[model samples]
Target: MNDRRIPGPLRRRPAAASLAAVALVALAATACSGKAEEEGGGGGGADGVATDIGVSDSTITLGALTDMTGPYATLGASVTQAQQLWADQTNDAGGICGRDVELVVRDHGYDAEQAVSAYSETSSQVLAYSQFIGSAYVNTVRERIDGQDQVLVLPQAWSADLLGSEYIQMVGSTYDLETINAIDFLAEEFGLGEGDTLGHVYFEGAYGENALAGSRHAAEELGLSVAEQRIAPTDEDMTAQVRALAGDGVDAIVVSAGPRQAASVAGVAAAAGLEVPIIGNNSAFAPQLLDTGAGPALLANYYVASPALPIGAEEGTPAELSAAYAEAYPDDQLDNGVAAGYSAISLLGQALEAACEAEDLTREGVAQAMLAMTEADNGFGIAHDFSDPAAPSSTESYILRPDADTPGGLTVLGDPFTSPLTDSYTRE
Candidate 1:
């Protein structure tokens, strides 16, 4: 649970000597094929694989625009480190597409301006973005990434607003769907139905607003009521918000903000004698929170809904990744971010390998390869279909309750599930 900030941009490349030999061979094979040179900024490799901006004879570059000094600073650090570990493992296993994978990381500190600036600065150098962390920031450059550049971008944010872009790959269920599942879990827990009211406290941005949409839809379907409280990302103290929800007599509260906000909501609500179930989206809970003052309250009443299995899940991939991540960074705390970051890049690596097999490693090639993937699984207890650009990878979410004794501080309440209500959800 190191809360230290990463000061500047960091670049990482796998150090494998075999990559040099592979590069020499590619250069030799493409020496006479000047057609790649004539076609803008690409070249041919050993397997006649076409190369582009991020792809070279020996390396393929990807970008990671993350938040290391802002609201999700600690989570962002774990995710970034996990991606780096994935890169190392991929290189060790004979690099993808006959080249080593390199990650060029930029920390945007969760500022919109800094996010856009980081994207602008690194977009040209990388073949695609492996990890873009913010919803609004990604939206700001959606047109450019989807229309102009047409490079594949796997975003860490899961707003339904990000869907339908041909090149933007969403790995998990969107925020809205995740919220629907969370609200349902809460309702079922409290045995509330038609007459119950739920309070939703969320950030005033793409991420929170998207989840709020879910709460509204769930309310409509389940014949319930929703009371909304929108707050900025900087508003950490939840005393006022909790009291407002308490005044509304909400049976349960849905929080779609960061861990700080979630903790505040739990602490304030418990202190105010506002005894109601509290739920949050995937990014809302962190393992370190169990060591805080709100730990008991969270363990008693808080729940989280996530699109993927957490690091503590007793699944094959989660088990493997948890071990690898711990070994890679012994001092770092185990969290779902490690699982998320690895999953995102592992999927991207699959696309890269597919592009190489298609003999076109250009941005367009990688994008097409991704779209063509009808079935993809990273062994995270769920299967994803990338064939549809208008829909998210999956509609299923794993409902979890906080447990102080759990490895990741949360335990799955049941198997991953897709609510029947999800089928009626229309992506907006």
Candidate 2:
């Protein structure tokens, strides 16, 4: 194994182009419509699909379809916390364009039907959907956002469909790319042989499927074959899944689940007796998973992605973000989901900021602001430019490995690698 996990500052960053903040212009869009009505939504969804109805006054109301309970609770919690931190920071710093932000949280319990109801019920009131989970659920309500010309989306799942169209802006690597990122790092940085079979254990849902699709693509590209296993989210007994994987002599396993579901599958996979490495989705980096009584099963051979810096995990990235969020929310967990939420809000803040600058606070205007944003610093990773209508996406994904040794608990590998821009996403 020729593991090489060092900083590669040699890679040039994408030019600081303008990002599209059409949401900010949303206020202007409604304003320009003359007889425009707030209609209750804050923003649109997928390809500028109107998931959120409209916004009135300077205060923007954002609707969210979050997972407070069920499979993704842990990750959902982090997503919520991140958004909360952003709101607090923005509010404290005098909010978007001198206007206060009104955020509404609705629990989806990781259910698609519940998600649709939550979005439908709240869409009429907020301007856009924030921190909503799953592509399955997002697709359910995509048209509503489009019909109203609203922008409703954030940086969550790595679904590939978001890469095209103007309705949605997904801010991470695509399914194929994110999955490839982990394998790429495992092989290039961790120094593993291409002949090894990459074991995959995932839920039978879109979240897991998207990853599976991506991993399969990458594996083929990397000259690797995959040993696949699917398990129910609620099934506690993973003896079947793990044993099947072990029987196949799997080399490495990448499991995707929120927390509870992840713990169930990870525990099974670890105890499956192969002693292979067990990797997980970015959401699996929570302390909950490590402390799930799956000790050795996870201790050394287990790793996951720290999408955002863990509370105070590493320096430069983690510490800085931690401090900012801590100051924003003096009392909170500041765990995994919060970090993601914080980043999402920061992006939204930038969108709003640009919208204010463009004098386009209407739905279309804010969408314009979100999409036309040239360049602005929101204190996160890279300076995103959403000016390109043809290819509306940003590729900024950080790689992290959290182990027992690090005092802060997580170790960041290197600078975030840019997902192929052409294959990136557009925030709806």
Candidate 3:
């Protein structure tokens, strides 16, 4: 993995810039049409003729609304690269059900308004959204998607609320479930069972609150005490929060924010001479942290709970996928984000293939295909079952500890963990 921070210029590569410009002009020219193209003749059944917005005789267009220039740009870049790789491979294999896949990537800058504007411009030209990067931006356009009958593959699985959207397919466990599994792993790993105090440092929103719900549930179930401090996402320094947790003498700290916040909490706690382990939700940790001044602190204390196995997990589909990615993009870092992007696209491909088989290649058909999926192989160790509409795609997760030898700066602690809480968890 590269230790250097992602350069700003890398976000605006000339090829992508030109693609965006052309897409914008094309969008403007067809803005008044307000109707999708109806090209026919494809691999679907008689009724499965391609007539949707982005489908044609030889191509199927999909849109990716990502944060290429925002706070999560590094993660977004990895995701976009992975998606492109999947599309390229699919096209090379005679395309999905005979039509080539065309992926249109757009930068939303992690801003709600920008995401909405970008969606509006590209909505009429695409069959579905292959990626919607941020929670806030997804919320901004959630209603629009439902109204337009468009299916979306969401980047964040932090909120159960997203499950309410019939058109959205979440690729992994919800934040709450991930946290529950994390607590279960930590309790067993550290031999600190009943009566231990757990501290939660979180951002104040659906993501944080959902994670807190799991912590509180675990506390009740395991006879542990809980303390919490909520902060804004913009808050960089967490010295005061760590001080408070330290003062409370919490046995462990659970972070439900982003990478910067994770770095801050770990660094601050270490600076305060507190030594309890600091566990982070999937979104909380990034490999880039290893390159920062806080690397030592994170390496010493930070553990991550993720729904998928690390890309480099030994002798499995994951390792194979990682090898393929390295061959495709040798210079790029192989991290959880890249794995996530690949999994999302892989899941979408399954649905697309199913839709093609059923001869119903419309947006509704894709949603139906996804909902009908009994299980999906992510090209990783885990397989998600989506047969139950009310259940999440995944409910188990692996506990990862930082390791210098791993591509993602982390290695799986053991086999993936699943608690009874997973089976019963549902959207509130």
Q: Which candidate, 1 or 2, has the higher TM-score?
A: 1
Per-model TM values vs. the true structure: 0.89, 0.79, 0.86
Tens digits of lDDT, candidate 3, 1-428: 11121111101011001123234443453343344433322344334564556777778888888877876677788788888888988999999878899988899886655776777677777777778876555655555566643655555445655665557777777778789888877777786568889999987766788789888888877888998999987788998999999989899999998788899999988888999888999878778888888889999988999888777688565677777788999987777777778878888888889888887777777878888887688666677766554456777777888776788788987666566644444334
lDDT by residue for model 2 over 1-428, one digit each (tens)? 12233222112122111113322333333333322244443453332323224454456777677887877776786678667666776778887655678788888897756665666566556555567777666655555455653554663665554444454666544554456567766776555457878888776656677678767766776678898877766665666877777777777778765555545556776555566666677765566456557654566666665444555455444567677766765764456665566666677667766666765555566666667665543444545555553332444456665555543345665666643321322222
Error of 2 at 319 (Å): 2.4
lDDT of 2 at 65: 79
lDDT of 1 by residue, 9-83 (tens): 211121111123233432343333333224336767777898777787899989999999999998899889999
Q: Which stretches of candidate 1 lie over 4 Å from their true place?
A: 1-40
Best by lDDT: 1
* Model 2 RMSD in angstroms: 8.0
